[model samples]
Target: MADQLYLSLWFPNFRFEALPAALVSVLRQFALVSGEKRVTAASVYPISFTESPVYQRIYVNDDRAQSTEDSIIENAVAEATEQLHDDMAYEFEMKWNLWMPEGNDTPISEAALDTLWRPHPSTVKILGFGPHFDQATYEQNGHIRVDFGLDTPWVMDEEQEEVLDEEAQKHVQQNVEMLLAFTLSVEKNCGISSRLLWTESGEPLAEKLIARLQRLN
Candidate 1:
């Protein structure tokens, strides 16, 4: 149902401290290439959006490929670990439907929004939308919090949706959990993870995610 690309890397003599910084630096490269507004690297489930790697499959389509951030990530890994000559980079496998929604709660509507707008999943046009934002979020000792504005991530007020009604707040909370779940799933296989809390002041999850986030192609 879904396609999964698994990459396992072994870097010799790589210190744990250096590994974390290496991942963070490479992630920063991702934000720059994808123009993603925000990301959290400290979560148990890490996720980011650029474009559909499938579009670049070349085995079938290419014209519809908006961009190939997925490939960029792959190449980034090679370059990232290049300094560590002792490390060996090998393994490139793709399985279908790896990121299927299945029983998750991100909602098709919000996902669709991310599909169309937000981070411009099909192209790099998102840069024209506005400045990008990055963040660091963590769950330590069962306590969760986030530091937004990688560059300057503050609450976005498209209109005045700052004070969300109770129902709206609940919806936001749900999607936040859904995002966490989805990101975590990818991280489980990719050796990366992220958890970023998004609180919709008064807007719907679909509106906020689609308008603000960049979905996986």
Candidate 2:
């Protein structure tokens, strides 16, 4: 089954006052890896995730023209973290392209499988936690968390009982490489003390990917 994926990052001796800079660094790393320089939106949630955002800004609105400065990683982070507090969370959304299968009800033939998958833009969320937000959830979720949404792009339709052909394997491998590169970049560039890539189902993603690749071999 496909599961939600997340990357948790912890910084050494992190201080609450440095969250905005940390958030900007992480977002900049994301832009470098994903090639999507502009943050689409940003939100500041007070107390917990259950509460409505105290501050929200959508840069991609159709009614407003986005200025060059408006999308800058530093500017977006500054805007969202302007009302920074120990009981709030800051979230930024950005786009990253990944190979995904087009929606089709019919079973795809091996020869047509390659044509069904294409590089599509996916929204990824990078959130920085305040010390007291969500009851100090950062102690477990890390100081910063990246929500990559679904794990489908990495493993492909595992439940379908379909074997990946060479072309299909190529696309899947590319997606995995992109993910690894991004993870490495974030760790290397963001001054992260430790990082973890996890799934909502509590299953290790590496094991599933290894199994899938073993089948391909």
Candidate 3:
């Protein structure tokens, strides 16, 4: 797996003015720890990796979670709107950096993957394996598309097959399923218009996100 998987969210109908308060309300519900200085605020949430506190992260294990959070973001958008048909969007992102050691293919169990990945029954609708690419400069091309639900086995790849057995593959599949479910959950909750897009880059995140948003529009 790569060193990190980046997930970005944007509202196709929200403006920049909807932030701070909107973000604060949504973060509070998820029990995030935030630090604000003047106009800048940083929020942190602790997420479990393999049942241990490897590093900070977050997750949603239920479907209603999306609806609940969506309401908060939507309300913020409504308040920030000046007209009846304002078409601004909120652009945000989340990244999952590999906290655990890379070369440790300890063959996770299927049951465990199920618990970690599948947060809801409807999440089972995910497909495995996204479109393959061989370009060396793909990550920096800036043409990346966010295709979470359509991809099958989104987590595992050929490298995993080289290390894991059939059983392990199955477990990884579940993990991918859970990833899909979780992605959907965030999309619903955060009220994002586009799917989660990923890439590896040395450029600023804000610049990358703005470019992607232009493409979507």
Candidate 4:
């Protein structure tokens, strides 16, 4: 038998289990929501793990789920498989302590669940690319250089757009902006202990788009 455990995301501040309907709707891609504003993506976090979570349960809905006596590994896959009606892949998010698969023996999917713990393919990847942009500070020279990137593989040319297309180009630009916003929000959450800061765009862009973001901000 293989090991498995529950997988969950913990938001200590909010009493509600952090699962949001919008986030679930975008399960095929990344979804970041701070109050009202939101950002989305395709494959934001990817995980290829040697081991599974402490709990092997995976849920595909907007609601938090638990493992049942009849809920075996095959059943969980059936659950995730049922939700695969859409066009893309998605990672699983578990609220901390609610439910997770446990283990390290073999990848949870193939292994039979002897214990409650088993590997969830989605959990294996979500931790690699955290649900949100987790900020990491790097000190270079005398300044701090904040760095961030998508947790999952950022798909650049899914539809063979590697060639050339106006719509594809615009989509690529929007993707970059989405990633940038994720990085910025995470940086703000870090304990900077500062009252004021300046902002500027490091990349070149059309003047019109730049002005639009500024106006909206």
Candidate 5:
């Protein structure tokens, strides 16, 4: 069994957005709501495809998410998958950071959010040049990485904890469900398609994962 799971959500018609700028906007909005007087900011870098023409990361130190935190990962994944199956069916990788600011910014509209992200023509060329963006050549030529991390409190010691034990098994199952849900939400909100790839090479676990997610629907 793999300890960590890797999933990708790629946007086919996704016009690449300047995520750093958008993140800055998001954080600024957060500050406004929290009543923090200091100017909020983020560290933007191109962790992937840096040498290339595109920049893809907007790093932040804040512990808060852009939306409600309860089962957020799950909701995002489920919603995203439903949206994808309903619309474009192409495969995708998830690398972007998504956060919905907290406030009564509701009537703001997606159009208003569009101002934060600018389209990059170079990324369009790079993505469209390949048949599937997940292919080896595309990954090499446009080597940009999107980073997302899942944090939980259920920690165990290798010397004492047996993974197959009932409690341990339950924790593992919860993580898997959260990953799937997060992927779905990304697709739903971002207009992207996603696929989950296991870091550990094996067929049985992968099959089991697919089965579980399918059963979820």
Candidate 6:
């Protein structure tokens, strides 16, 4: 089974007023690592996830001129965090490419496996949490939480009976390297004091990746 993956980052002596700059740093790091320069969207949720956003902006569109300013990491963070408060959670969405199987329903033979792998764009959410938001979820989820949607690009379908071949293994390894590179870049460039990569099911991603690699071996 594939699970939702998240990277949580904590900063030492962090203050709510510093969130905008921190968010810009994190988003800029992501752009540097993933090569996706624009932030597609941003939203500010008040109090908790249940409440409607107090502020929202979408930069993705056909018109390049309109989104030019707002799509930039610094400007997007500034606009979203303009009304910053302890109970507001600011979220930004960006794209990252990952290797994925083209078709899963139809199983491919060894000879055709290589043709089915390609780089697919995936949505990555970078969220900055205020201290009082969601009853202080930041205490456990960290001041900044990166929601990487699904772990499929890393582990694929673990439940599938089909064993990965050399081509499949190669693609999987590429995805893993991309994930590692992004995480390492965020840790180094974002001035993070601590970080955690975890899954929705409470299972360690490293253990699962090790198991998958062993199978591939």
lDDT-best of 2 and 4 = 2
Residues 1-217 of candidate 1: C-alpha lDDT, one tens digit per residue: 1111111222334343354344434344335433442321111111212322211122111455565443443353343333332112111211111121223333322233222212112111001000111121111200112111110111224332334333333343443343444334434442334423333232233344445433211
lDDT (tens digit, per residue) of candidate 2 on 1-217:
5689999999999999999999888888888888889899999999999999989888863456645678788888887887779999999999988866665222233325445777788889999999999999999899999999877778555544366566767777777778878888988888999998899988888666667667766
Could you estimate the TM-score for every candidate?
A: 0.25, 0.87, 0.35, 0.28, 0.35, 0.87
lDDT tens readout by residue for model 5, 1-217: 2143333334444332332222223223323332332321112112222224231222222466453432222232233233221111111122322222123232112213222322111100001112233333223222222222221111223322332344333433454554455445444554434443433333334465656445434
Candidate 6 lDDT over residue span 175-216, tens digit each? 777788888898888888999999999988967676666766
lDDT (Cα, tens digit) per residue for candidate 4, span 148-184: 2222111222332334244433433443455345334
**Candidate 3 to truth, TM:** 0.35
Candidate 3: minimum summed lDDT over ten consecutive residues — where? 122-131
Q: Which stretches of candidate 1 lie over 4 Å from their true place?
A: 1-71, 85-163, 186-217
Clashing pairs in 2: none
lDDT of 1 at 100: 18
What are the C-alpha RMSDs, in order, of all predicted structures?
15.3, 3.2, 15.3, 18.1, 16.8, 3.2
Off by over 4 Å in 3: 20-154, 201-217
Global CA lDDT of candidate 3, please? 0.32
- Which 10 successive residues of model 1 have the least lDDT summed? 122-131
Candidate 6 minimal-lDDT segment of 10 residues: 104-113
Q: What global local distance difference test value does model 1 have?
A: 0.28
Looking at candidate 2, what is the lDDT of residue 179? 82
Question: What C-alpha lDDT values do all the predictions have?
Answer: 0.28, 0.82, 0.32, 0.28, 0.30, 0.82
Candidate 4 Cα misplacement greater than 4 A, ranges: 1-49, 62-162, 192-217
Superior by lDDT: candidate 2 or candidate 5: 2
Count of backbone clashes, every candidate in sequence: 19, 0, 12, 41, 22, 0
